[model samples]
Target: MRFTTRVLLLQLLTVVAVVATSTAVFIGLSMAQLRDEAETSALMIARTVAAEPEVRELVAEEAQDEENPPAEELAQGQLQQYAVAASQSTGALFVVITDQNGMRLAHPDEDLLNLLVSTSFSEAMEGREVVAWERGTLGESARAKVPVFAPGSDTPVGEVSVGFERAGVFDDLPRKLLFIGAAALLALVIGLIASLILRKRWEKLTLGLQPEELVVLVQNQAAVLDGVGDGVIALDTDGVIRLSNGAANRIFGILDSENLTLADLDLADDVVADLEGGTARDGVVANGRVIFLEARSVDRGGQALGSVIVVRDRTDLMALSERLDSVRAMTSALRVQRHEFANRIHVAAGLVEAGRMQEATEFLHTMRSRGPVDYPLVGVELITEPFLQAFLGAKSLEASERGVSLQIREETLVLGNVAEVEDVATVLGNLVDNAVTAAVASDELRLVEVTLLDDADQLVIVVADSGPGITPGADPFAHQPKKLAENDQDSGQLKDHIHGHGIGLTLSQDMAQRRGGEVWLVEPGGEKSRRGAVFGARLPDVMEPDDSVNYREVQEEDK
Candidate 1:
């Protein structure tokens, strides 16, 4: 059954039980009162008959006789007179007298006067009043007996027994009690029904609210927050975490996705300190990286509850801003160079016009060959040796300018037509650029190691940088993008903008992913090195010969 129905049933049954018990108690009390009243009325009638003067006179005359004459003679004379007078005065069924031995002395029926009376009458003749309700010769009756005394003496003579036919009078009380009991029972049933109806209505009204509703609301809200990229952490009043979305969990390194607790994440001391202090703070870390941490107090009903901590990855944001600054700088420098080049072209044109053709040709050749480095990083087959030499040489210069030493430890392997030459260059260029930037702050021994190896199945390029290693924390990619700053004017501001660095790493990571490879940090550990970061890029090698290749052959070649 539904919960509301069950509750209604329970309440109805409880009401019914209480009503039933109370009704039974009331009926019992009424019956007892009725019975007492009936008995008292019967006794009063008997006493009234016994106190009559004629009834007393007859008893004294009976006592004067030596032998109480046979009841037949007394019934025809003195008993007749007493019975007529007493019955007339008192509204009794019959007035009968019995001697000490229970022989009827005077009776309303002459024939019964000769019959011996029951022991109850003999007991009554000995000066005891007896009242009984029973089925007698006159049908259902209430009978009472009172002893009579002699006129001038204190001696009892005979007993006067009065019986009132009570099938009507006595039955009146029980009938009325029965009517009362029936009415009470009906009222109890009606009250029980009304109570049940009210209880059911109340249960229906309360059905909409349940504890599970709260749980569902919480889960849905948390799921929506999880879809956001920014890290969000909510806590209760006891400094315990109540909600942590995916972004927050990633930023804090909390592993359990289903059941998470505050103590399991092990947040950094700085972050925890800010949380406890209940104040918003932003600062840079020792790694030349910037982090913005904000703490806001949560409240309910004007009472301070707990605090929420939001942590944002600002590394990319700072980098993009720096890139914008660099672009502006490069634009200004290019403008100056453009003006200088225009003047030189004017001077060179004058020389050619004055017939110094050799000098003019040489100047033109130098200008054509000495342009900025421009080459497609992907989708290329064979290149001119001069172009190759210039490109490689420029990469070396670029590394040196950034305070980084870059070296190719091994010769590049040609993986046949299956390997896209331009793709290789693009992947390597990005990786090398990132390595150089990361190692810029390193000591004299700062070096970026680049290695390329090709096997039957895949070509692997490894770029290792000598710098502070990647910290152990949550996965950055798993979280959604943070909300864009309201004051930001550029689309790049929505990206992960760290405070200190440029956008090289984030751009390189995106390129790596697009090429169907992953960029991961490996802890450089051994007796030779304390710690650094190594990033590896693996791409499929799909070289094919003139003949078809089998799976077994490919496996054997890979081995």
Candidate 2:
């Protein structure tokens, strides 16, 4: 059956049951009360007939005789007349007067007079009134027996018995039952009307969907929402969160999504603003993860529904981009060194061909001792790791090309192989790139200083420049990109990654934090500062290694 029909039927059945039970109880009590009324009326009539003064006098006279005598004609006639009148007035079936010996003196039928009564009369003769349903010569009835007394007499002179027919007592009961049945029917009708109204309301509340449809909808939601890898958040028109996927919960680091809203989550202001604006936003940082979000308004039949937000985590992609930048910087420096070496070789060849053999030998010796492209200004002699040495050399060359000086501090010392060199390079490389950009923009000397320290337990890199420090009233480690958009061009990061939208410092901080480390600004590069901004990144558990693998040896072994 349809759910609405079933509900209506149930309501009708409940009303019927209640009405039936109540009617039965009421009818039972009414029948009892009517029967009692009949018995009481019969008893009252019998007593009144027995109390007549003339009949009492005649009965007393008749009893005065010593010998047993027949009922006195005058007394019996008067008693019979009175009985007839009482029976007619009270609507009793019959009225009978019997002497103390149980011989009837007055009866409804004249032939029954002077006959022995068919039912018990002993209790009435002994001065006790009796009332019960009994079978007698008059037929079945609710009968009452009362003792008749003479004037100032304690003894019963005779007994008066009155009866109401069994059928007559319940004559009006059928009409009452008809009314009660009608009331039950009326109640059922009211209940059905209420059920119909309720059904309409229920349909509206459920959006005209049935119970089975609702169940299927819930099941589909669970299967689809939790299965997707990308995070999904759905909101109503009022910005209330209606649905949030498991991936969204994980991305926001929330334990429960119940009663959650966009404002309740610790999302970056830029990301939230973009979502509210109903536009697609890329490179938005949230919860230390590079997030790209697409927000689009949903509608049904041109009616506004709400919005759905899709979030993509791009932290790993941004890290890779930073590493690629480092490699590119190194490649450019190698090309410069290779071109310089080629020029030196050509010069030595020309000198030898001129027969100046001693000058060519000294020239080759000098080139070998000093090494080609020795950037003497940056203090590269103190750094020993080839990768770091080459990477910093490339950065210095790149800086000089941009008209900015890149300097390595004299106190910097890193003597062992870094276990995670790519991670370290990503952090320091971004810092150097940003510093170089800032130095190029500064009016003071265009110089950038770098400090690398590996103190066995941790790796620390500090980059300071001659440019203005960080923007005032900004937390350097925060994921806010407002300062970067205002003052920097994302430090010239990749175009595709969200971190490229000015999260360089945030990316470095996230990488360091992953290894139980931190990144912070030692000085804000603004107008009030003597020097440029200085940023420091410290990574714990970045210890020195006992041995290092050579790229060439590994390739030769594979061959």
Candidate 3:
């Protein structure tokens, strides 16, 4: 049977056993109670009969006779008439009057009128009344015996005995038992109904999964939650953290999550509110990791089971993605330069073949005058690092396609190779993208400018735009501009509408903070401001110190 059915059956059997035992006990006690009542009634009736004047006088005369009275005379005796009348009036089975020798003076049966009594009447003859359940000529009965007294003396004359048949005394037993049985049956039915209701409730709660199935499910869930790389946290409807996997515990620095709430964890108010509001977001920085987060509510059978927050780390993957994009950009730039260089070489060779030596030489001089063909952007040589050169070249191309001019400011300077390339790229990518976006929104001289500098292992990046600047006292990190999101060509999905410059700003700030740095708005411009907003980021330990020994320094000293 199913688990619920088993429980129901056990409960039903328990109710049956209890009801049956209780009913039987009531019946047994009732029989004794009824028998006691019958005996009391018989004793009272016998006492009244023995106390009568006629009965006392007749029994005294019969006891005084030298010879027993004639059987026929006693048989027709008025004493017998009195006994019959008493028996009829009292509703007793039989009533008998006996002499001192225990000879019957009066009896219900005429044949037994002058005969010796079947039961001992010593106690009655001694003037003592007795009540008992006894078997005599009339079969088993609850009987009472009493002694008759002389007219004015304490001397006992004869005895009176009255009995109620056992069957008649217990005549109400069946009815009482029937009532008890009805109650037991009602209780059984109630128990059955209660058990059935409980079974349904159990089935609904567990979705009819048996006990063994539930155990296996629980075990599997535990294994999966702990085994998976992504972080999982389960909260109740009240937002209390009921369960958390290993990754979540590590991320939040929680040793034990029992009875904790979202407030108890180290999460920002906005993040908490977003989670509570059942928001889904990706590429969010939390606790030094770029993670994808989504809060999903679970319900079953129209009952709310609360929500689960899933956190997947994308920090390493994003860094690799950026690096790949940079490589692709460099490869494209190289391929373009190769095709352009091949065309120029072909032209020069044709000029040389036609004996136009002066023209070919002038063409070579013109080609050499154009600084590196691999990077066509102006002041590209100012940024010496290959990664930065390629990354900026790609951004310049994107800006050029968007009808905006991207410039590497002439003042840009770096003393050493770039370090922490991925971290630097991530922050720069956001700031440059926003700057380009701002420039595109401007009608006057749409241009985005970038400045890169290094000061003792710190890489400082400043991006300026000619678009309308930020509003005064505004928090760019908290601003929500869906227009900027709608213009986003990345992801190409409607969900991008929820992501704004604020998300990028926040993510960038989080990355900077990890390196003991920060990204901040350096200049806030008004709507009509000629120069657009300027954003700066100071990333510590992103470049090598100039003081470090290198081949150039050693060669300079040798010279």
Supply the TM-score for candidate 3.
Answer: 0.61
Candidate 1 lDDT over 192-273, as tens digits, reads: 6776777666644544434456578668777768766777777767777776677765655555433443434544455567
Clashes of 3: 0
What are the per-model numbers of colliding residue pairs?
16, 7, 0
User: Is 1 or 2 the stronger prediction by TM-score?
Assistant: 2
TM-score of each model, in listed order: 0.41, 0.77, 0.61
Error of 2 at 260 (Å): 2.1
What would you estimate as the lDDT of candidate 2?
0.77
Segments of candidate 1 deviating more than 4 angstroms: 1-234, 241-259, 265-269, 279-295, 307-398, 408-410, 413-434, 437-446, 452-460, 465-498, 501-516, 521-533, 539-559
Q: Tens digit of lDDT per residue, candidate 2, span 1-559? A: 8887788788878888888899999899889999999999888876777777776765565456554444456235777787788888888899888777777777888776777899988898789999999998878999999887766897887788999998999998999899988888888888888888999999766666789988998899888788788888888888788888988878777766656777788666666787889877776667888777888888755667789888777777887888777677778777877898898889999999999999999999877655666763377776766667777888787788889988889978775656776778788888888788777766658898989887666888998888766655656555544443354432222111233477777788889999989988777756665667888889877656436645456448548
Instruction: Count clashing residue pairs in model 2.
Output: 7
**Candidate 2 has what TM-score?**
0.77
lDDT of 3 by residue, 1-559 (tens): 8889899989999999999999989999999999999999999999899999988998888889978887789878889889999999988999989988989888877777678899999998788999999999989999999989999999888899999999999999999999988999999999999999999999988988899999999999899898899999899899998888999877666688868987676565677888899997665655556677789998877889899999887766655565565556657766766787898899899999999999999999876754335443667767766667767877787788888888899878776677787788778877877777777667678788899987778989998888767755555765243454444321111111213323566667767887899988787764555577888999998887545547476458548
Please, what is the whole-model Cα lDDT of each candidate in the order they appear?
0.57, 0.77, 0.79
